[model samples]
Target: MMVKQERAARTRQALIRAAAEVFTEEGFALASLATISRRAGVSRGALHFHFDNKKVLADAVERQAADVVARMTGEAEAAGDALDALVAATHALMSRLASDIVVRAGFELCGGPTRNTGAALRWQWQVWVEGTLDRAEREGLLAEGVSSARVAPAIVAATVGFEVLGARDPEWLSEERVARFWELMLPRLVAVAR
Candidate 1:
């Protein structure tokens, strides 16, 4: 029983990993369950046993991705400056997007039109950023004229743009590119006192 349970867990993980790669490369609409199963090196029966359909598999991928993002950004909260934490979180996330297939797929899947999942990952990210920026404002990390409401969309748009552009030229996901973005934006974003 233990061995069977362990095998089942491994198979599930394999399916998720395979799905992430397929979804990342082909998008949710184009990704095929057969391809994902093949990539996972598991039988179609095993894939079905684990995930009833492509949507379920994609959901699993999205859930895993959310966890990844949560962990990635969770560290940023430890910083003394909320704005700095947001910047660090952005850097960490961009770096993850560059190197982690799962993270890229999760961000991609969040925007997929086919899925009706409530509050897509992108929205969740935007909300989180908005909250952090609000906190920064309270902490006086923001410029005199800068408002979290104003900055939230810009940050979200730029990050999403990086994810989209990274699809074509991976260099867009690099830390250097992300750093350059912050370098230009930060001076305008930080308070005069900061």
Candidate 2:
């Protein structure tokens, strides 16, 4: 029984990974269950037993990806300086997007046209960015003219843009790329460090 339960867990994870890949490549509308099953090397019956439909599978993928984002952001929140934490978090996200197919696919799925349902992952990131910026503001890290309200959207847009662009060209996900972005943007967002 234990072995059977363990196998079931593994099969479920395999389906999630396979679905993420298909959704990433084909988008939600075009991705089919057959392709995902084949990718997972599992029988149709097995796939159905685990996930009733493509949407459910995609949700699982998105949920798992959201967890990843939450963990990173939580770590960022633990830092003494919000600005440094934000920078570290962005690098972490770019690094994850570059190496983890699931994370990339999940981010894309969030605002996908065909899905047209929700963007929980992106929303989570946006909220985290806003909170961090607000913290930075309270700490008086922000430049004189900048406010968290004004800067949060721009930061979220830039990070999301990196994920979108990184999908086509990995260079966009490079540490150097994010560092350059921060180098240019951070000066404008924050005051000189004490």
Candidate 3:
């Protein structure tokens, strides 16, 4: 029983990984389950057993990616100071985004018919941004009355914009430029002292 369960788990992970790669390279409309099964080297039956459809496979990928993002956010929170934490988190996330084809593919899949998958990813980022803002406000880093609700969306927007830009011309956006863009933009949203 244990061996069977282990194999099943491995098969599931393999499908998720393979689907992410295919989706990232081909986008949702073009990616197919047969291709994903072939990539994973698993029987089509095994793929169906693990996920009901491509939508389910995409959700699994998004969940796995969100787990990674959540962990990085937690690390940033533990690092101290809101601005520094946010910077650290952004750098960590961008680094992962640049290297992880699975994550890049998950983002590409976000525009599909799976509203739940897209919402899950958006909510994950929003929660992280809101948490960072709340911490900054509590630490006296933000100007008084600065609402996390208001700033969280902007922060998320900037991050997404950077990701899109990086995706288009990775050579042009280098890590240094991405970091500098965030640093320059963050202050504009900081509360002005009277």
Candidate 4:
């Protein structure tokens, strides 16, 4: 029974990884379950046992990406400086998008036209960033003139833009690109001690 459960777990992970690859390359609409099963090296019965449909497989990918994001953001939240934590989290996200197909597919699935996943991973990320900025404002980490309301949207938009642009040119999601973005924004966003 233990061996069976272990095999099942491995099969499930394989499906999610395979789905991530297909979704990242072909996108939600064009990605097919047969292709995913083939990539996973699992039979159709095994695929169906793990995921009922393509949307379910995509949802599993999103869940995995969310887990990755949550772990990174949770670490950032543990930092002493909220503003610095936010910056670090954003940098981590850019690096993840560059390296992880699961993370890339999660964002892509959130924005796709086909099915509504109910909760968009991108929206969750935007909310987390906005909340972090608001915390920074409350902690007096933001510049005197900098407002969380104004800054949150811009940062979210820029990050999403990076994700979109990275789809075409991998350079857009590079850590150096993210660092350049923060280099310009940090001075404008962080408060200077009087």
Identify the leading candidate in terms of lDDT. Answer: 2
lDDT of each: 0.88, 0.91, 0.77, 0.89
Runs in model 2 lying further than 4 Å from the true structure:
none
Note the residue pairs that clash in candidate 1.
none
lDDT of 1 by residue, 1-194 (tens): 99999999999999999999998888888999999999999999999999999999998988998988888678888865798789999888888888888878887887777777764777778878999999998888888889999998999999889988997798998999999999999999998877
Write candidate 3's Cα lDDT for 41-101 as tens digits: 9989999999999888888898788788788888987897787788888888788778877
How do the predictions measure up, each by TM-score? 0.93, 0.95, 0.84, 0.95
Better of 2 and 3 by lDDT: 2
lDDT of 4 at 159: 88
> Which of candidates 2 and 4 is the stronger one according to lDDT?
2
The stretch of ten residues in a row with the least summed lDDT in candidate 1 is: 111-120
Global Cα lDDT for candidate 1: 0.88
Flag regions of model 1 displaced more than 4 Å: none
Model 4 has an lDDT value of: 0.89
lDDT of 4 by residue, 1-194 (tens): 99999999999999999999998888889988999999999999999998899878888899899989999898888875788788889888888888998988888888887868754788889989999999999988899989999999999999889988997799998888999999999999988982
State residue 179's C-alpha deviation in candidate 4, in Å.
Answer: 0.7
